[model samples]
Each structure stands twice: as structure tokens, then as C-alpha cells.
Target: MQLSSTTSGKAGSNPMGEGAPIVYVVDDDISVREALEALIRESGWQPRVFGSAQEFLSHSRTATPSCLVLDVSLPDLNGLDLQQQLASTRNDMPIIFITGYGDVPMTVRAMKAGAIEFLTKPFGDEALLDTIRDAIQRSTTALGQEAELQLLQKRYASLSTREREVMALVVTGLMNKQVGGKLGISEITVKAHRGQVMRKMGATSLADLVNIAAKLGSSCGN
Candidate 1:
């Protein structure tokens, strides 16, 4: 069964992975690509097959959790180099590497670079399936964390400039009077702002609020 990647709007399109997860296979061998595509379809994931790394990179990837099944031997770009490039861009798609001429050094490089699985040719379907399942689980976890961080950032962004200053001071163990003195404001005003900060951040305790501030400050470089 030949799957047309352009049947929908996106290039090398699978169903959008927003609702369901996606699995992408990049193998030069047509038979291998087709076989994996069939397997992925049977598992109810959206699968997109690409013949080269460039093709895969050019595709517009959705923000949903996705796994990449890449052949180590590619014509234009080395699989390891592609992995490096993806990492450089902060793309966290889990990868499964497959190769017919796989070697020890190659395996080490791919694994060290964070490939979920390194599969040699003639690998069992069950082995590949299990690996894919693990990769998907990892991808889902990563996506969840990223989504949570984004939401936290949005809540932090909702803070007013003055409220942000108060938050930073309060998280640093400053008393209301100390915060008020630092900002040339009244202690009562500081108390009001602190209460607003707690409400806006949905923080129940000062320790939890401090943790949230730490996450923000870490991202903000102090």
C-alpha cells in the first residue's frame, strides 16, 4: 500500500499528531520504509516515511510527541550528523537508529547522542515495536514537561513588573519591610503585592512560590 504524504495539506503528511502521536521513518530502502509504515499504521499512529534526512528535516513537525525511525546509512547526510543538528535546534524527538552495516563505534556514537534504540538489519518486529513503544513513552513524557514549563512561563509572564520585583524579593527570604525598603515602598504595599503574587501564581506556600521563582530566575539567568 503506497501512502501518499501529500494527500493532506502538510508535506510528507501524516495525520496531524496533535490528537494522536506520530512516528516518522526515514530509510532509503523502499521496502523497509513501507514495511515499517504498515507496522506503524497498524499500531494506530500517524506514520510518515522519508527517503533521506533532508526530507525529514524539511517537514513541518507538529508539537505533539513523535518518534523518528532513522536508517544510519543515508545518502546525503550522515545519521549521526542529523542527530547532532536536531539536538542543536533543541528538537527532542526520540530516535531509533537502524543500519545494515552497523558497527561498534557507530552504535556507541548514536547511543551516546541519545538514540532510543540502535537496531541492526534483520531485527525482529517485536523488538522494533517494543523499542518504538518505549520511545513514544519517552516522547510523551518530554512533551508533558515542556508543555508544563510553557504554561508556567505564561503564568510568570502575567505578573506585573512591580509584582515581579516583589516576587523576586520575597522568594529571596526578604521580609515585607525589607522588600518595601529595597523598592522604596511601604511595608503594607509590599504585603499587598505579595498576596497578589501568591494568588496569581496559584502558590499555596512560600516554599512553592520560591520554587516557581527559581524556575523563572534560572531561565532568566538570575
Candidate 2:
């Protein structure tokens, strides 16, 4: 189930590119959804409310700065189940679970699954708002990092196979002659390939290139 009002509305769209934050509410109770929507809107955020976990899943989400205000118990899929499902995807939206029947074990499980908060019902409004603000900040930072990593991946992918080998040995503190010996190539050819790697990666210095190589290697399981 989904609230008809929210289903037809946009939540995270910032048409002007001004970086607006979105709050997604998934709860079985209509009153809870409306209350969260009112609070989020009053705080200058865009809120989209859903009456069940499955309804929220059906909605398309973006890589924008956003967080989920989820109820632990839903009519369709439960909050924890939805979290597990999202774990298999690339979704990085911060989650804050609200439940009237919260327990220590449930809180631990949710936190272990990367939920920002697990608040019991009848919680203070100020507390929830503070957590939401923090969650948004984290989401923004996470999205920025994701974008940076993607750009680095693209840059790394532009390198030729020889250039990649050159980068690997160069970052290991190997001299050009040593790299050439390892690859059974001339020292002059090694220098040329090193220069190409630096140029393609937009690295200004050997140290910078080494750092970039380290980042790509760690991410690529090298």
C-alpha cells in the first residue's frame, strides 16, 4: 500500500541543482506517515510517504542526498527485511527506523545492518529531527565519495594495459629502469608509458600518481 498523495509527487528532485535533501517515510500507519511528512517539510526537506515497505521499494530512488524514516513493522515487508534487500543493491540511503515495539536485540540488528538510528515510538520530536539532520549530512558525504570513486574508476579505465603495469610497479617505489627490467622493456619506453599513465590519470606528481594507483588498486581488489 502507498499513500496516493505521495505516490504522485516527487521527493528528491532538485530541478534547480541547488542540492535539496529528501526524506523518505515508510510506515504502515497513515498518521505516522503524515506526521513525518509534516515534520520533514517544515524542516525544509522534501518528504515522500509510503504506507508499506513494498510500496517504498516500488518507488524509484536516486543517488541524491536522502535518508529513510522507516517503521520497523510494515504491512507488507518488514523494515529489517527491506534493509536486507537494499543491502544487495547500490542503494546508500541512510535509514532511521521507528518502532513502537523496539527492543535491544532489534536495535542491535538494525544498527549492524547500517541503520543510522532505531528510535522507539513516542520519542521526542527534537531527537528525531537531530538524527535526521545528521543522517542527511552523512548521506551527502557518502554520495560525494561515491561520485569521486566513480570518476577515479573512469580515469583508471582509460589507461592502456602497459600503462596499468607501469603504474603498478611505479607506485611500488620502483625506478623507471627497474620497471623496464621487470617488464623486459627498454628504460626509455618505460619512461614514456609512465608519462602516459600520469597524463591520463591527471596526476601532477609521482606521489600523486602513486596515491591514485593505490586507490584504484584497493578498490579493484589488486
Candidate 3:
């Protein structure tokens, strides 16, 4: 199987040997599954092939960077239906659809549902591999953002209620005096809570604290 020039250059760049990104293939056809497995492995990704959507769904998903190469027609649930099932649970797992009998509406629906690429077989090996690479890159980015958000949430959870109150106020450009007035506390107490919020949230400056609050979606209560 010939890889795209882009795939060739990137195939050897993966530094995570045993923990390489996974490319899942869910197709009823044995031949297509085997072919994709070889190409995916050659391109330096772990390939997990399933004969049906149910089999794929049964597999335990890890938090590794990964994407799915799904055939539109499956023995059980169709690819689009499977995509729907995964939408809420696995937003980080990008999907690339492949089928020999693709249609305009099918393509539109798949793309609308956030599929990375929809290829009708016999698509070129290069195209499939290239799309898989792009999907994996997208998954990597999404997973990173998710992990960051989770960590941020954990840090936010660690704050005392007073510190959270101070953060909500401080990030909204409130002075310690104003925050204290709003919360019915002394300015010195507000300053102490603000310092704790900054330390707990890992914010070096007020601007940094503001950004963190925005990400946390904290409503600065009046």
C-alpha cells in the first residue's frame, strides 16, 4: 500500500513507540479490514479492526489519541448511527467514513455529524491514510484540550467558597475593596482570598486569573 508523501514524512515522526495513537477500523469486510490494518501499522499507528459496530462499541476505550475508520454499511448499526452513539461519549474520537455506495445526502449527513472525511471506495490508499493521519492529529488536539479542561476543573474544585467568590469578582476587574463590599468582607480578607485563588488556579497575574475564570465559565455574581 502506497502512502501519501505527507504520510511518508510523518510515519516515522511518532515518538510514542508502544503507546502510539490508535486508528480503529470498523468494517464487515475482512479484506478491507486487513488492508487497512497493514497500511495503518505501516504508517506507525496501532490498528484495531472490528467486524461490526457492536464489536467496536464493546471494546474499552482508553484516553489515548485515536480515531475511527468506519464503513457506512455495517452488519448491525450503520456508520451514521454509530457516530451518533459516540457523539456524546467520545467527542475526541474523530470519525472517517468509507463506503463503496456513498451518496450526496449520506456525505452531507456524515459531515454534518462531524465526520472528518467521507471516502467512497475504491478510494486511493494515499487518501485514506492521509485522512487517518489528519483525524489522529485532530484527536490529539481534542484530547489535549479535554485533559487541560479537566485539570482546570480539578483546580477550580480545590478552592474554598470564599476563594471562588473572590476569583469571580477579581476576574471581572473588581478591586479588593469592591469585592469585599460585595461579599460583605474586609478588603484585607478579600486580598487573602484573592491570593489563595491565584495560587490554587496557578495564575501568575490578574489577567491570567481572568482567562482561567473564563475557561471555568464562572459567573461573577453581583
Candidate 4:
């Protein structure tokens, strides 16, 4: 299974396509980690192997957009514990679990906890590769969305108080004169604020500004 980069710089496009998605392989067994790393590299992904869960967690926070291939049983904290820790911190990294002695209930629990795949020991290479590809795709989509939302939030944060008020009124279908009247300001002042809002928000058009404002308003409500 060959994986290709599919990154785009658009607002909602994945940023991991410029290179192979980094795959973090966490396992206690040296052989298992080495084999998985070799397989990942052969499949066109960059692999980083960790001897245990603690080792993997010590890496600096990354925005490179990747997935994890973890062993269910580890020397220190188990894979499930690691998964819980990541989820608690709102990290959306996809995980694929490999276990030598997984039970039905354990598999169900892993799936319920948002694992992308669970493979028993001695699984075929094709199956493992397929699951990894799917997990990487999902992680890419999630990271892209997160990046876009952060960009939107940053743009919104750059607005002045009066500029934000003008933006809200303008997007809600108010004319400059009406907005000025509502805010007890001159129409010229409103025009100036609107221009500032547009420039700061990097809006290409009134409709784009309106869409962004609408998204912000809805998110705030939620």
C-alpha cells in the first residue's frame, strides 16, 4: 500500500500532503516496532518508533498531521491510557491498535474510544497498510479543519471593538448609514470601520465577511 501526499493550502485543505504523514509506532517489543517501521517506510510514510507509550508522549506538540500505530499492551502506560490522555487534551490523532491477545470486549472498548482499527497479532500486511492509510486520511482531514478554525479565530481576534460592531451590523444586512445610526456614529466613521474590518479580516468581499461572521456567531452560540 503506497501512500501519496495530498496536501493543499486552501482554508479547509490538509497540510500533510507535502510529505508522507509521520506515523508514530508505539510498542514494547523491539521486533514489533522495527517490523512496523520498516513496513511503514516501504509504504511511503515516515515512521517514528517508540519503545513505550511514555517515549511517544515526550515529543513536542506537533501540527504535522499524522496517525499512531500502538500496541494494546505496553511496558509503562498502556495504549488505552495513552489514548485517553490524548483525548482529554482534545488531540484528534487517529490510532490503530495491534494486540497479541485481544479479547472481544477489549476490541469493542477500543472502537468505542475512537480507535481507527484494531488488528490482532499475525495480521496480514495488506490489512495493516489499509487501516493505516484510512487512519492517516482521517487525521489529515481533522488537522485541516482545526487549522482553518484557528486561522478564522486569529482573524476575528485582530478586529477592534468598534470594527467588530461594524462588522456584525454589516454582515447582518445593515447599510453603512443604518449601522452608523444604530451605533450612534457618523456614516463616514462607519465606512472607515468597515474598511478596517475588511482589511484586518482578509475578506475578499462582503459576502465572504458575512459568511465568516455567521460562522463565528454560530460557534459562539454553541
Models 1 onward score TM values of: 0.86, 0.88, 0.90, 0.78
lDDT of each: 0.81, 0.81, 0.84, 0.78
Candidate 3, RMSD to the unseen true structure = 5.0
| Number of the top-ranking candidate, with lDDT as the measure | 3
Tell me which of candidates 2 and 3 scores higher on lDDT.
3
Model 1: residue 107 alpha-carbon error in angstroms: 1.6
Worst 10 residues of 1 by lDDT: 1-10
Residues 1-222 of candidate 1 have per-residue lDDT tens digits of 223331222226565345777888888877778777777777878888888889888888678778999898898997888888888554558999998888899999999998988988888888888988898888888888778778778888888888888988898899999999999999999999999989988889999998877766664213
Q: Lowest lDDT 10-mer window, candidate 3?
A: 4-13
For candidate 1, list the clashing residue pairs, or say none: none
Steric clash count of candidate 3:
0
- Give per-residue CA lDDT, model 4, range 26-60, as digits (tens): 88877776677667766787777788888888865
lDDT of the structure predicted as candidate 1: 0.81
What lDDT does candidate 4 reach at residue 101?
A: 86
What are the root-mean-square deviations of the candidates from the true structure over C-alphas? 4.0, 4.0, 5.0, 7.5
Q: List the residue pairs that clash in candidate 2.
A: none
- Per-residue CA lDDT of model 3 for 1-222, tens digit only, reads 333322222212233365899888898977777677777877888878888999898888888899999999999999999999999999999999999898899999999999989988888888888888898999999999888888889898888888888888888888999999999999999999988888988999999988877776743332
Q: Considering lDDT, which of the candidate structures 3 and 4 is the better prediction for this target?
A: 3
